[model samples]
Target chain A: MFNDFINQFWPSTVDGLAFGSIYALIALGYTMVYGVLRLINFAHSEVFMIGTFGAMFVPFVLGINSALTGLALVGVIVLMILAGMLASAGTAVALERIAYRPLRRRGASRLAALISAIGASIFLQELFALIVIPNVFDRPQQGRIQMALPQIMERTDLFSIAGHPVKLHQVVVVVAAVGMMIVLDRLVNGTKIGRGIRATAQNPEAAVLMGVNIDSVVRMTFLIGGGMAGVAGALYLIAYENTNYYIGFLFGIKAFTAAVLGGIGNLRGALVGGVTLGLVENYGAIFFGSDWKHVISFTILVLVLMFRPTGILGESLQQARA
Target chain B: MALALGLAACGNGGSETTPADGGSNAAAPGTVKIGFMGDLTGANAGIVIPPRNGAKLAIDQYNKTNPAVKIELVEYDSQADPSKAVALAQQAIKTDKIVGLVGPAFSGESAQVGPVLEEAKLPSISASATNVKLAENGWKYWHRVLPNDGVQGPGIADFIAGGAAAKNVFVIDDKSEYGKPLADAVRAQLATKGVKVTNDSLDPAESDFSSVANKVAAAKPDAIFFGGYYAAGGNLLKQLRDKNVDAKFLSGDGSLDKGLIEGAGADNAEGALIGCPCYIATPDVTDAKVKGFADAYKAAYNADPAIYASEGFDAATVFIEAVKAGKTTPEDINQFISTVDIAGVSKQVKFAPNGEVEAKDIYIYQVKGGAITLLGKAAEAKLG
Candidate 1:
C-alpha cells in the first residue's frame, strides 16, 4: 500500500517541477515590478498574451514555406525566437510607457495601476479579436494565425532520465528562466543601476535627493520584467502552439499566486515560490485525485498566508521599504 | 456596474417583442425567427459561433429563394453558464419573435432552458446538447438535432475497448452535471464490455493538470477519456505531454472544438480521438444542395463546418418542412414536426415521441496531422 502511494508521489513531484518552471518565469516579472514600484502590473498577463501573438507571428514572417533542410529550418526558427523575443520586449516597453509610466509620474495610488492594467488587458484582447490579418490564402481567416511550421514545437528527448521523456519546452522554460533570473540577480545586486532601483524602492524622496533618476529605474524595471514575461509568453506558445485572446488570464492568475506564495517583492522568492507552488499543486492533484488538485493549491496558498502573511519569502511592504 | 446593467437592460428592452413560442396566429407570418442562446464570450463560444454562422448561411440562402417565410436570427450569449441561458430563453420567447429555437449549445444549459420552453409550449430544438436526461425529462417542447450521450457513451466504449482493443482505460470528468454523468455512462458501458477502467473527477475551473497526468500516467492506461468541454480538456492534453505521458486520448463532443487541437498543440495530440455525435459522411449526404451548403459554410467560416451546424440547419429545416406541410399554426406545426422525416446534413432527421434523433451516426475521430479523420461511424442506439 505504501509502495503504491510512494510511486504516485514521485511522478506528481516531477509534473509539478515541470509546470513550476513556467510559473516561476512569469512570476518573476510580477515580483520584480512590484519590488520597484510597489504596484502590481495587472497588464502583465496581456503582455504575456502579446508575447504569444509575437511567437505565432514570427514563423510566418520568416517566409519558410515548407520543411527546409533541417539546418535551414533551425536557422529560421532561431531567427523567429529572436524576433519574437524582441517583439515581446518592444511590447513591454510600450506598455510601460503608455499605460504605467504616466501613473507613476502622477503619483497615482496602486488602485489606479490595477484599473489601468484591467483596461490594457481588455484593449489587447479586443485588439487581437478584431484585427484583420492579411490572408495569403483566399479563404476568410479566423482570428488566429497558424504558422506553417512543424506542429511539434518542443523536442522530447533531452532530459529523459533512463527512458522517461523530458518535454523540450519544460527544459527551455527552466533554463531560460534560470539564466534570466541570474542576469536579473546580477543587475539588481552588482550594478550601479541596481543601486538606483534599490534607492527608489527604499525611499523615493531620499532617492531624488540623492540624485537618482527614479524614472529611468522604473522604466528599466518594466523593460526587464516585460522582457522576462515576453520570453515566458513566447516559450508558452512555442510549447503549447496555440494563441487566443484570453488564454493569458488562466496562466496569469497562477503566476500571480506563485508571486504571492513566494513573498511578492522578492525575486528569489518568486522563483522559489513559483517552482514550489507548481510542484505542490501538481502533486496535490496526484495524491487527492485530479479533481481536488486546484482546491489543494489554493488551500496551501491560504495556509501559507495564514502562517506567514508576508509569504514564504515575501517581505511586508514596511520591511521592503526599510 | 450599473452602467453594465443598464446596457444589458437596454438590450433586454429591445428583445421584449420576441414572439411567444406558440401563439394562435401561425398563419403566414411573412418572417420566422430562430432564437439562439449560447455562450458568446466565455468558453462555449467556439462551439456556439461556428454553428450560428453555419445556420446563418443556410438561412440566408434559403431566404433568397423562399420569400414566403424568411428566418430571422435572434441571439443571446449565455457564456455557457446555465442561469444565463434561462434568462436568454425567456427573452427569446418573449421578445425576439422566434417561431422555433435553434440552440443553447450545451447540455446543462439545454437542461435548464428546456423546461422553460416547455412551460411556454414553444417547440425548441438543441443544435448540440446531447445529454439523455434532457429528452427523458418529459418536456414536450424540447428536441435535439443530435442523439444523446447515452448512445454516444456506449458507442465510444465499443470503439475504444472492443475495436481498438485498448486494455486499460483511464476516465476523467470535469465534475459538471453533463461531464460527470457522461463519464459515468461511458464507465458503465466499458464495465459491461469487461474493460478495466480507472476514473477520476476534477473541478472544471482549475486549468492545470500535471498532478492528474502524473497519477494517471503511473497506471499507463491505454487511453485517457475526458468528458468535459475544451477549456479544461485542452490544458489537460497539453500538461499530459508536458509530464511525458504518451497515452492515447479520447473524449466526447464537449471536447470537439477546433480550439482543442490548437490549444493542446497539434503534434503532441496526434492519435488523440474524439467521439462526436454527428458528422456529414460525404457519400451519405449525396445531395448537391447539401454539398453546396457545406462549401458555402466552409468559405464563410474559416474552419470546417461542424456537424452541430448541420444539425442546427436540420432543426431549422425541420421547422421549414413543418410550415410547408400544414396551415402554419402552432398545433399544425407541432403535429407536422412530430410526423415528418427528412434527410438533412448528418443523417435522415427524424424525431422520436420524446423529441430525440431517431437515426444518426455517433462517430469516433482521430486527430491525425491536425485534422479530424473519422474512424468508426456507428448508428445511434435504438433504445428498447
Candidate 2:
C-alpha cells in the first residue's frame, strides 16, 4: 500500500489541489461572513449551487452545444465566470437583505439567525430539486437527474508525471484558483475597501465610531466572498461536468470545515486549510482506503481545534493590518 | 340461553359496523383490499413510484373488467424506511385487512416487513426488491416477481468472464444497501472464474469521484464494474472517461436508466454496459397482451414505463388472479398465489417453493447512439 501511494503521489497531489482550490474558494465565503457578522453563513453553499446553475445556463442559453477553442473559449469562460459571480453575489446580498437583515432588525438571537440560515439552505435545495428540475430543465421525467453541462473547454493531455498524464482542465482549475486567490489577497490588503473590511473585523463598534459604514462593509464582505464561491462553482462544473440541486450539501460541510480549520476569519488560513484537507483526504484514501477519507478530514479538523484553536495561520482577518 | 345468544350477535354487529362506518366503505358485499407500499416521496421514490403506478394501472384494469370480486388497491408510503415499512405492514394486515401486498419497494424494507406479512399470512409479491437473502427467509407468503440480486450479479459477471474475457476487473460500489451487496456478488463470481478483481467504494452523497477515478486508471483493469445507481455511477464514468481510462464500464440495474447517459454526458456514456432483471416491451414484441399493457400504461400515466413497472403489474396480476378464482381471505389468497402460473408483461410468472420467481432472466442493455438500447440477455451479449 505504501509503495502504491508512492507511485501515485503526483497524480493524487494534482487531484487534491484542484479540489482543495475549490474548497478554499468556498471557505472564503464562510470565513468572511463569520468575521464580519459573527454568524456562520450555512447557506453560503447554496449560493455556490446557484452560481453553478448560472454558469450552466450560459452554454445552454447560448446554444453552444459544441466545444469552443482559442479566443472564443476564453471569452465564453469569462462570461460564464462573470455570470456565476453575479448570481452568487446577488444571492448573498439578497440573503442578507431579505433573511438575515429582518432578523437582525428585530434583535433576534444568533441561534435564530443560524436556524434561518439552515432553513434558507433547505428551501433553496428543495426549490431546485422539485420545482426547478422538473418544471424548467430538460428531462422532466427524471426529477432528480443531474443536468450535464456542455463542454466549455476541450480537455487535452497537458503533461504527465510518473507516466500518468494530467488533463488541461486539471491545470486550468489549479491556475484559475491561484489566480483568484492572488486577486482576492491583493484586493483585501492593498485597497481602501480592504482596510475598511479589516477595520470592521478588528472591532465593528470601533470601526463604526471611526465613521465606517458597518452595513456596507458587511455587504461588501458577502459580495466578495460569494463571488469567490461562484468562480469555484464554475470550475467545479468544468471539473465534474455535472450539476444537481443537492451538490452543495456535502461541499458546504467540507468548506465550513476548511474555514474553521484555517482560523475562521482568516483569508490565507482558508486557503491553507482547504489545500491541506484536500491533500490529506487523497493521501489518506490512498494509504488507508477511500472509506477512511471522511474520518481523516474530520480527524484533522478535530486535531487542529484541540491543539491550536486559533488555527494553523494563527490570526483572524485582523492580521492583515497587523 | 336466549340472552347469551343476543349478546354474541350484538358483539359481532358492533365489530363490523366500526370499520364499515369509518373508511373501508368499499368493503361492501364481495369486495376486498390489497396493498401497494413503497417510497412514494423519498430518495428511492424514483425507483418506487414507477412500480406503484404500474400496480395501480393493473388493478384499475382488473376492477373495470372483472366487476364480480372487486379489489380496492390501498397505498402506504414507507419512504424506503424499514421501521415505517414494518408499521405500514401491520396496518395493512390488521386495519385494512388486505389480502395481498405488492411491495415494500426496497430490500431493507422488504426484509423488515417480510415476517410481519408472513405472520399475518398475507400473500406478498415484491415488484422490485431483489435481495437473494429475502428468498432464504422461508416465508411461504412472501414472493417476488423478478430475479434476485444473486441472479443479477452473476448474470453480468458471467458475461464479463466468458464473453468479454477480461482477466483483470475493477469492482466498485457506492456502499449503498443496494449497491454493496450487488457488487459483492459480482466480485465473488469473478473470483470463482479466476479473474483478478480490484475493489473500491465511493460515498454516494458526494458527486466528486476524482480520487477513485484515478485509482481505476492506475489499476489498468480490463473492465470496470460499478454497483450503484445512475447519478453517482454517471459522475464516476464521466471522471474516468475524462482521464481517458478507456476500460469497459459495466453497472447493475441501478444504473440502467437514461439518466445515466444524461449524468455521464452521452459522449462519455457510449459503450457502457448496464444490466437489469426487468424487461421492457419494445416495439417489435408481437404479443398483443404486452403491447396492450404498454399502451394502456402510457395512456394512463402519459409516460413510458420505467424499470420494474411490468413486474409491479405482474405482482398485482397475481393477486387479481387469486381474487378472480374466488379467493377472498388472506389464507385463500396465499393458497391461490402458490399455484400461480401465467404470462406476465415482464416475463413468465411462476414461483418456486421458496417464493422466488422461476423464470429469472437478466437482460443486458448498452448505451448506443446516445440512448440506452437493449442488447438482449446478459448471458449472450458479447460486449467485449
Candidate 3:
C-alpha cells in the first residue's frame, strides 16, 4: 500500500513544484516590492503579460528563422529577453512615477496606496485591451519558432524516474524560482545596498536620518521586482505556449496571496509561501478534483490569516534585520 | 468601430434597392451581405481567424466565377464574450443589412445569437458552432454547416467502444456550457455501448490538478475523455500522467490543437486520442476544385485547412447558389436555402427541416510526437 501510494504521490508532488516555480517567480516581484516599499505591485501581472508579448514579438518582427546557428539563436533570445526586461521595467517605473508617486507625495495611507495600485492595474489592463492584440487586426506575431528555449525550460516528461511521467516545465519553474530566491537571499544578506534597503524598510525615518537616499532604494526595488515579473511572463509563455491580453489576472492574485501567506513584507516568506501554496493547491485539486482547487487554496489563505495574521513566518519587516 | 465597418460594407453596395445577391444579373444594386460574429481577437481567434480568411478566399473566388453575384461579408469581433455576442447579433441584423450571417464560431456565442437571428428572419449559417440545443431551439433561420456535438460526441464514443474495445471510461469536462454538454453526449453514447462511465468536472481557470489526478488514477479507468479546450486539457493530461494514470486520453475537437501537444508535453500526450467532427483531409474525393481551394487556404493562412474552412467555403457557395436560384429577395433567399443542395467542401450539403445538416463525417486522430495523425473516421447517416 505504501509503495503504491508513494509511486503515485511522489510524482504529483514533483509536478506541483514545477507549477510552484511560476508562482514563486511572480511572488518574488510581489515580495521584493513589498519588502522595500510596503506596496503591492498590482500591475505586476501586466508586466508579466508584456514580457510574454515581447518574447513573441522578437523573432516575428526581426524575421528570425529556425535554421539559425546555436550562437545566433542565443544572441536573438538574449536580445529579446533584454528588450522585454527593459520594456517591463520601464513600464513598472513609469507606473510608479505616474500612479503611485503622486499618492506617495500626498502622504497617502496604506489604504490609499493599495487603491492606487488597483487603479494602475485597471488602467494597464484597459490599455492592453484597446491597443494590443485584443483590438488589433492580428496579434503581433509573437516571435519566430514557437518553443524557442525548449532545452532549458521544456515541460517535464511523463514519469522519468521509475518510468512515471512528469511535466518538465512544472519542475523547472519551481527549481528556477527557488534558485532565484536563494540568490536573492544571498544578495540581501551579503550586499551593501541590501543593508540600506533593509534599513529603509525597517524604518524609513531612521534610514533617511542615516543618510540613505530612499528614492534610489525605492527605484532599485521597482526595477528588480519589475524585472522578475518580466522573467515570469516569459517563462509562462514557454510553459503555456499561448499568451492573451488578460493572462495576468489569476496569476497576480495568486502571487499576492502567496506574499501574504508567507507574511507580507518578508522576502523569504514570499518564496516559501508561493511554493507551499502551489503544492497545497495541486494536492487539493488531486484529492477534491480540480473544481475545488481555488476554493481550497483561498480557504487556506483565509484560515491562515485568521489564525496567524503575521503569516507562517511571523517575522515582521523590523524583526527581520533585528 | 464595428458599426462603421458594417456601414462601410453596405454603403459600398452602390444602391439601396438592388439586392447584393443579384450578382451581375441585375448588376445587384445592394450588397448581398453575410455577416460574421466571432472573437477576432482573444483566445479563440486562432481558430476563428483562419476560417474567416478561408471564407474571404471563397468569396473572392465566388465573385470572380459568378460576376453577377456580389456577396458582401461584414464581421464583428464578439471576443467570445456572450454579452458582446448578443450586441453583435443585434447590430448584424438591424444595422449591417445582412441577409444571412455566418459565425460567432464558439458554441456559447451561437446559443446567445440564435434567438436574435430567428426574430430578424435572417438566415445564419455557422461553420463551427457545435452545441446540440443550438438547432433544437426551433429557430427557422438558423443553420450550421459544421456537425453538432450530438454527432461528434457519439461518433467518438463509438470509436472508443468499437475500436479500442474499452469498457471503462472516465469523462471530464471543464464545466463550461460547451464542455459539459459534449461530455454528457459522449457519456450518454458510451453508456449505450455498455461501457461504464466515470465523470469529473474542472474549473478552466485553475492551473494545478494534482489531487484530481490522484483520484482519477485511483479510479483506474481504461480511458479518459476531456471535454474542454486545449488550455486546461493540456495541463490535466500532463498531471494525469504524473500521477501514473496509464489510461488512454481522449477528447473531442476542443482538445485538438498544436498547443495541446506542446503544452501537455509530447511525452505526456503520446498515445492520446482526439476526434474532430469534420474530416476534410480524406482523399476520397479527387476534385481539382477542392485541391485548388485547399492550396489557396494554405497559402493564405500558413496552416493546414480544417473542416471548418471547408464548411465556411460551403456556406459561401450555398449563398451564391441561392442567389443564382432566383432568391434575390430575403424571403426568396430563405425559401431557396431551405430546398437547395450543393456539393460543399466537406460533403453534399443538405439541411433538415430544423436547419441541422443531414450528413456528417467525424475524424478520430491520435497525437504522436506532437503530431495529429488520422486514426479512423465515423459518419452519420442523418440528423433528426
Candidate 4:
C-alpha cells in the first residue's frame, strides 16, 4: 500500500485537488448560507444541479457544430459560466423567497426549514427526472440516463507529473476553483455589501440595530453563494462531460462533509476541508484500495466531529472564515 | 406538512402501466396472471426494458392462439433494488396471485426474492440474474435461463489468457452484488490460469472515475476487466482512453448494452470486448427462430431486441406451457413448470434438477465501428 502511494503520490494529489476544487466551490454555498441563517441549505445542492443544465442548454439548442478556438473558446466558457450562475443564483434567491421566506415569516421551527430544504432537493431532482428532461429536453426515451455534452473544449495533455499526464480540463477545474475562491474572499471582505454580510453574520440583532436590512443581507448571501455553486456546476460539466438528475446528491453530500470538516460556517474552512477530503479519498483509494475510499474519508469526518466538534478551523463566518 | 407528505410518497420510481396487449385478452375459460418483475425505470433500466417487452410479446403471441386460459403478464417494477424486489415479489404472490414469475432480473433482487418465492411455492424462471450462489439456495421452484457467473467468469478468463494472450490483467467491479461476485469469480479463475491480476472496485452511481483511471494508468496492466453495467464501464473506459491507458478492456454481460458505447464514445470503446451468456439478435444473426422473434418484437414495440430478450421470451414460454397443461393455480403451475421441455428462441428451454439452465455458450462480442458485433463463442473467438 505504501509502495503504491509512493509511486503514484503526485498523480493522486493532482487528481484529488481537481476533485477537491469542485467540492470546495459547492461547499462555499453550503457554508455561506449556514454562516448567516444557521441553515444547512440542503437545497443549495439542487441550485448547483440546475446550473449544470443551464450551462449547456444554449449550445445544445442552437447546435454548436463548429469547434471553438482561442477567444471563441474563452467566450464560450464565460457564457456557459454566466448562464450557470444566472440559473443557480436565481434559483437560490427564488427558493429563499418561495420555499424559505414563507416559513421564516411564519416563525416556523428550524426543523421545518431543514425539512423544506430536503424536500425541495428531492423535488428538483425528480422534476428533472420525470418531467423536465423528457418534455423540455425532448429526450422522452430514457429520462434517467445521463445527457452527455459534446466535447467542446479540446483536452490535450500539456505536461506529465510522474506518470500522470495532466489534461486541460483538470487544469481548468483547479485554476478556476482557486481563482473563484480568491474573488469570493475579496468580495466578502472588501465591499460595503461585504461589510453588511460580516456584520449580520457576527450579530444579526445588532446588525439590524445598525440599520442593516436583514432580509436583503440574507438574499445577497444566497445570491453570492448560489453564483459560486453555479460556476462549480459549469466546471463540473466541463470536467465530467455529462449531467444526470441524480448527480447533485452525491456531490452535495461530499461538499456538506467538506463544509462541516472546515467548520460549517467558515468560508476558508470549506476550501481547506474540501481539498483535504479529496486528498484523503484519493490517497485512501491508492493505499487501502478503491473499495475503501468512502470508508476512509467518512471515518475521517467522524473523527473530526468527535474530537474537534466545532471543526478544523472552528466556527466563524465573520473573521477567520476568510 | 405538505413537503413531508410529498417526500413520503416519492419512494417508488416509475408509474406502473399494464401493457395494452395483456389486459384485453382474458376472454378464455380461465384467466391466470404471471408477473414479470425487474427495474422498468432506473439507472439500469435500459437492459431491463427490452426483456420486459419481449416477455409481453411472448404472452401476446400465446393469447393469439385462443386457449382455454388467457395469460396476463403483470409487471412488477422493482427498480433493481433488493428490498423493493422482496416487496414486489410478495405483492405478486399475494395481491396479483401470479401463478408464475418471469424475473427479478438483477442478482441482488434475485437473492432477496428467492426465499419468498420458495416459501410461497411459486415457480420463477429469471431471464438475466446470473449470480452463481443463487443456485446454491436450494430453492426448488427457482429456474434460470442463462449460464451463471461460474461459467462466464472462467470462460472470460480463458479467453484473456488463451485468446488475447495477456499476462497482466487488471480487474475492477462496481461493488454491487452482481458485479463483485462475478469479479471474484474472474479473479479466482485468472489465478488458476497463471495470470497476474490486480483488483479494484468503483460505484457507477458516483459518476467519477478519474481517481480509479489514474490508478489504472499507474498499475499499467495489459488488459482491464470491469464487472459492472454499461454506464460506469463506458465512462471509466472513456477516462482510461483520455488518460491513454490503452489496455484491452473487457466486461461481463452487465456492461454489454449500447449505452456503454454511448458513455465511452464509440472511438474509445472500439475493440472493447464483452462476454455474455445472453445473446442479442443483430441483423447478421441468420438463425430463423432468433430472426423471427426479433421481427415480431420490433413489430410489437417498435424497437430492436437486445440482451436477455430471448431469455425473457423463453421464460414466458415455460409459463405458457404450464397454461397449456391446464395448470392455473400456483401449486399446479409451479409443479408443471419443472416438467416442461420446449424449444424456444434462444435454445431448448429445459431446467436441470438444481433449477439451473443447461450449460450454453458464453458468446464474446467486440465493439466494432460503433456497433456490438458477435464473435461466436468464448472458445472460438480470437481476442486478438
Candidate 5:
C-alpha cells in the first residue's frame, strides 16, 4: 500500500490540487450562505450546474466548433467565465427572491428554509432534465447523457515536476482559482459592502440597528458566493470536458463536506478544507484502491467532526475580518 | 400549491386517456399490437436507438408485404430504469394487450421485467440484454437474439490471451449489472487459459480515471479488457494512453461505437478491439435475406445498421412470422416462438431449452482509421 502511494505520489498530488481548486471555489458558496443565513443552501449546487450550461451556451453562440488558439482562445475563455458568473449570480438572486424571501418574510424556521432549498434543487434538476434541455436547447436526444464540452485548448504538458508532466489546463485551473480566492478575500475584508456583510453575519439584529440593510448584504453575499461557484463550474467543464444536469449533486456534496471540514462558516477554512480533502482522497485511493476513495473521504469527515467539531481552520468570522 | 394541483390534474388526465386509447386500439380488428421497450433517452440510448430503429424497419416492411394483418408498434422508453421497465411491461400487458414484445433492451431492466412478461405469458425477444444469468432465469416467455456473455466472454478472453498474444491481462468493470458479470466471466476464462489476470472495478459516474490509470501503469499488464459503456471506457483508455502504457485495449459490445472514438480521441482509440455477439453486416455477407434487410434498413434509417440492428430486425421478423401464422393471443405467440426455427439476418434463429440462442457466435472488430472494421469471426482468429 505504501509502495503504491510512493509510486503515484506526484501525479496524484497534481490531480488532487487541480480538483481541490474546484472544491474550494464551490465550498466558498456553501460557507458564505451558512455564515449569514445559517441555512444549508442546497440549491447552490443548481446555481453551479446552471453556470456550466451558461458556459456551454457562450461557445455555442460564438459558433466555435474547432480549437481556437492564442488570443482568440483567451478571449473565449474570459467570455465563458463572465457568462457563467452572470448566469449563476442571476440564478442565486432569483432563488433568494422566489424561495427564501417569501419564507423569510413569514418568519419561517431554518428547517423550512433547508427543505425549500432541497425542493429548489430537485426542481432545477428536473427542469433542466425534462424541459429546458429538450424543449429550449433542442437536445431531446442527449437527455441525461453528459454532453461533451468542446476542447478549446490542447492538453499539452507545460513542464515536468519530479518526472510527472503537468498539463497547461491544470496550471490554468489552479492559478485562476487561487486568484479568484485572493480577490474574494480582499473584497470581504476591504470594501464597505464587505463590512456590511461581516456585520450582518455576526449579528443580524445589531447590523439592522447599525443601518446595515441586512437584506441587501445577504443578497450580495449570495451573488458573490454564486459567482465563485460559476467560475468553478466553468473550470470544471474545461478540466473534465463534459457537463450534465446531475453534475452539481455530487460536486455540491463534496464542496459542502469541504466547508464543514474547514469550519462551515469560515472563508479561509473552506479553501484549506477543499485542498486537504482532495489530497486525502487521492492518496487514500492509492493506499486503499480507487473504489474506496469515497469511503475514505467520508470516513475522514466523520473522524474530523468527532474529534474537532469546529474543524481544522475553526469557525471564526470575526477573526477572519481581523 | 396551484402548480402542484394543476400537475396532479394533468397526471390524472393522462392515466384516464391512456387506457381508453389502448382499449380502442386493442378493439380494432386485423391490427396486431407489438410492444417495444428500451432506453430512448438515457445512458443506454446510444446502444438502444439503433435496435429500436431496426425493429421499426422490420415492422414497416412486414406491414407493406402483408397488408391484411396490420402490425402496429407501440414503443415505451424505460430510460434504462428497471422500475420504469416493469411499469411499461404492465402497461403493455394490461392496457395495450400486445401480442408480443421486442425488448426490455438493457440487462438490469430485462431481468426485472422478464418475470412479469413470463407471468403474463407474453412472448418477448430482446436484442441486446446479454447477461448469461438472464437465460438461466428459466422464463418461458423471454428470449434474446444476441448470444449471452457466457459465449462472448470466453471468445473475448481467447482473442486477448491468444490472438493478441498477451500473457498478462488486466480486467476492469464498471460494476454494473451487465459489466461486472461479463468481466468476471472473461477473468475466469483468461485464468483457465493459463494467462495472468488482474481484476479492477470502477464506478461509472466517475469522470476521472488518472488514479486507476496510474495503477494500471504500475501493474504493467500487456493487455487491458474493459467491461463498461463507452463513456467510462473511452475516458479510461485516453488516461491510460496519456500515462504511456502501450497495452492493447479490448472491450465488449458496450464500447463499440463512434462515441468511443469521439470520447477517447481518434488517435488514442486507434487499434482498440471490441468483441460483440451481434453480427457485423460486412459487405462479404452472402445471405440474401441479410442483404435485403440491410438494404431496407439503410433506405429507412439513412445509415448503415449498427451492431444489434440485424438482431433487432431478426427478433421483430420472428414475431411477425408467428403473428402471420394466426397466433393472436399471448399464449399462442409464446407457444409458436418456443418451437419455431427460422433463418434470420444474423443466423439461424432457434432457442435452446433454456431460452438461449441455439447456435452462439462472437465477432471480433478492430478500430482502424476511425471506423470499426470487421476482422472476421472470433473462432477464425488463431488462439494460443
Candidate 6:
C-alpha cells in the first residue's frame, strides 16, 4: 500500500495541479461576487460556458482550421483568450443589469436574488442549447454531442518528472491559469477600485456613506471575476479538447465547492481550496478506485465543513485583506 | 351472476365501439401505421439518427412500389431515457394505435419499452438494441434484426485469440448496461479459450485516460478490448498509443463508427478491429441488393450508411413485407414477424423462438486509412 501510494504520488499530483488551476480560476469568480454583493452568482458558470463558445466561434469565423502552427498558433491562442474574456465580461454585466439589478432596485430579499441567479443560470444554459447555439452558430446538434475543438497545438511531451511524461498542453494550461490568477490578485490588492470593492464588501452601507459608487464597484467585481472565468474556459478547451452545453454544470459545481472550501469571500483561500480539492480527488482515486473520485471529493467538503466551517483560510470578506 | 353478465356485456360493447370508431377514423382501410422510436436528440443521436433515416428511405421505397397499401410511419424520439421510452411506448399503443413498431434503439430503452409494447401485442423489430437478455425475456412481440452481444462477443474473442493470434487481452468497459455485459461475455469467452485476460472499467464522461493508459502499458497485454461507445473509446485509444502501448485494440459494435476515427485521429485509429453483427456495405461489396441500397442511401442522405442504417432499413422492410402479406391486426403482424425470413441488405433476417436473429454471425472490421474496411466474416477469419 505504501509503495502504491509512493509510486502514484508524482503523476497524480501533476494531474491534480493542472486540473486545480482551472478550478481556481473559476472559483475566483464565485469568491469575488460573494465578497461584494453577498450573493452567489450561480449564472457565473454559464458565463464561463459562453466564453468557451466565444473562443471556438472567433477562430472558426476567422477560418483558423487545424492547419495553424508556430507563431500563428500563439496568435490564435491570445485572440481566443481575449474573445473569451470579452464575451464573458459582457454576459456578466448584462446579467447584473438585467437580473440582479432589478432585484436590487426593488430592494428584494437576498433569497429572491439568489433564485433569480439560479433562473438566469438555467435560462442561459437552455438558451445556448435550444436557440442561440443552434441558430446563431449553426450547430444544430450542439447540445447533444460533445463538440471537439480544433487541435491548435500538437500534443508533445515537454519533459518527464519521475518517469511521468508531462505534455505541453498541460503546462500551457497551468501557466496560463496561474498567470491570470496572479494578475487578478495584484489588481485586487493594488488599485483604487480595488479599495472601493474592499470597502463595499466590508460594509456596504458604510461604503455608500463614504461616497463610493457601490453599484459600479459591484459591477466591476463581476466583470473581473467573469474575465478570469473566461480565461479558464479558453484554457479548458486546450486541456480537455472538447466542450458541450452541460460542461459548465459539473465544472461550476466543483468551482463553487472550491470557493466554499477556501473560505467563500477570500481570494487566496479559493486558490488553496481548488488545488487541495484536486490533489485530494486524484489521490483518493488512486486509493479507492477512479469511480469513487467524485464521492471522495464531496466527502472531503463535508469533512472540512464539519471541522473548520470557514475553510482552510478561515476568513470572510470583512476580515481578509485583498 | 346478473352483475357479472352485465359487466361482460359492457366490456363487449366497449371493445366493439373502439374498432367501429377506428374503422371510420382518419386512417383509411389500406393505411397501416407503424411507430418508430429512438434517441433522435441525445448522446446516442449519432448512432440512432442514421437508422431513422434508413427507416424513412425504406418507407419511401415501399410506398413507391406498392401504391395501394400505404404504410405511414409514426416516429417518436425517446432521447435514450427509460421513462421517456415508456411514455413513448404508451403513446404509440394508446394514442397512435400503431400496429407495428420499428425500434427503441438503445438497449436500456428497449428493455423498458419492450414489455409494454409486448403487453399491447405490438410487434417491434429493433435495429440496434443488441443486449442478449432482451431476447431471453420471452417477449413474443419483440424481435431484433442484428444478432445480440452474446454471439458478437464470442465472435470478437475468437477473432482476437485465433485470427489476431493475441496471447493476452485486457477487457475494459464503461460500466454501462450495454458495455459491461458485453465485456463480461467477451472475457468469459476469452478465458474459456485459455487466453489470459485482465479486466477494468472507466467513466465515460472522463476525457483524460493517461493513468489508465500507463497502467495498460505496464500490463504489457497483446490486445485490448474496449466495450463502449466511440467518444471514450477514441480518447482511450489515442492515450494508449501516446503511451507507446503498441497492443492491438479491438472493440464491439458500439465503437464501430466514423466518429471513432474522427475523435482518435486517423493515424491513431488505423488497424483497430471492430466486431459488429451489422454488415458494412463496403464499396467492393458485390451483392446487387446491398450495392443498390448503399447507392440509394448515399443519394438520399449524401453519406454512406453508418453502422446500423442498413439494419434499420432491413427491420422496416420486414414490417412492410408483413403488411403486404395481409397481416393487418397487431396479433397477425406479431405472428408473422416471429417467423420472418427475408434476404435483407444486411443479412438474411430470421428470428428464432427467443426473438434473436437465427443467422448468428459477426463481421470483423479493420480501420484502414481513416475508413472501416471489412476484413471478412468473423467465423471465416478465425485460425486454428
Interface RMSD of each: 5.5, 5.7, 6.0, 2.4, 3.2, 5.9
Query: What is the per-residue lDDT of model 5 for residues A227-283, given as tens digits with 9 covering 90 to 100?
Result: 999999888777776677887988898899999999998999999999988888888
Q: Write the per-residue lDDT of candidate 2 for residues A1-322, one digit (tens) a residue.
A: 8777877688889889999999999999999888878899999999999888878878877888777899998888888888888988998998888779889879899999999999999998888776776676664533455688867777789998878888888888899989999999998899988889999988988999999998899889989998998999988987787888878888899999998888889999999989998898898888766767899999999999999998888688876663
Best by DockQ: 4
lDDT order, best first, reads 4, 2, 5, 6, 3, 1
Candidate 2 lDDT, B246-363, residue by residue in tens: 9989999878777678778888899998888988765456789888888888888787777788889999999988888888888998888889899999998999989999997999
lDDT of 1 by residue, B249-297 (tens): 8899888776677667677678878888877433235578677767777
lDDT of 6 by residue, B1-384 (tens): 322322222222222212322212267668878767887766557788778778878988888786678887766767688888787778668766789989988899999998898888889999999898898788999889998898989999988888999989989888887998899999999999999997667787776665566456546899999998887888788778766678999999988887777667677799999999888776677889999998898887788888888999999999898888988889998888877889998989998877788877899989989898888888777432
What tens-digit string does per-residue lDDT give for candidate 3 at A67-159? 344567457646656666676777778877887778888998878888778888877776765556433325343111122222233333634
TM-score between candidate 1 and the true structure: 0.84
| Tens-digit per-residue lDDT, A1-322, candidate 6 | 4565677677778778988888899999999999888889999889888888878777678865474667888888898899889988899999999999989989999999989989999999888877777776776754656666656767788898888778787788889988998888788788888888889999999999999998899899989999988898888877666666767887888899999998999999889998998888777766665656678889999999999998888797667663
What is the interface RMSD, in angstroms, for predicted model 5?
Answer: 3.2
Better DockQ candidate (3, 4): 4
Clashing pairs in 4: none
RMSD of 3: 5.9
Tens digits of per-residue lDDT, candidate 4, A122-190, equal 999998888888787787746687877666777688798865688888898899899999999999888
Q: Is the docking of candidate 5 incorrect, acceptable, medium or high quality?
A: medium
TM-score for candidate 6? 0.91
Ordered from best to worst DockQ, the candidate numbers read 4, 5, 2, 3, 1, 6
Model 5 TM-score, all chains together: 0.93
Query: TM-score of chain B only, all predictions?
Result: 0.88, 0.88, 0.87, 0.92, 0.92, 0.90
Per-residue lDDT for B86 in model 1?
A: 81
Model 2 spans > 4 angstroms off? A138-143, B1-35, B39-49, B69-99, B112-122, B138-140, B287-292, B295-305, B328-331
Best of the two (2, 6) by lDDT: 2
- Across B316-345, the per-residue lDDT of candidate 3 in tens digits comes to 777777876657666677787789787777
Most TM-score-accurate candidate: 4
Q: By lDDT, who's the top model here?
A: 4
Candidate 1 share of real interface contacts: 0.49
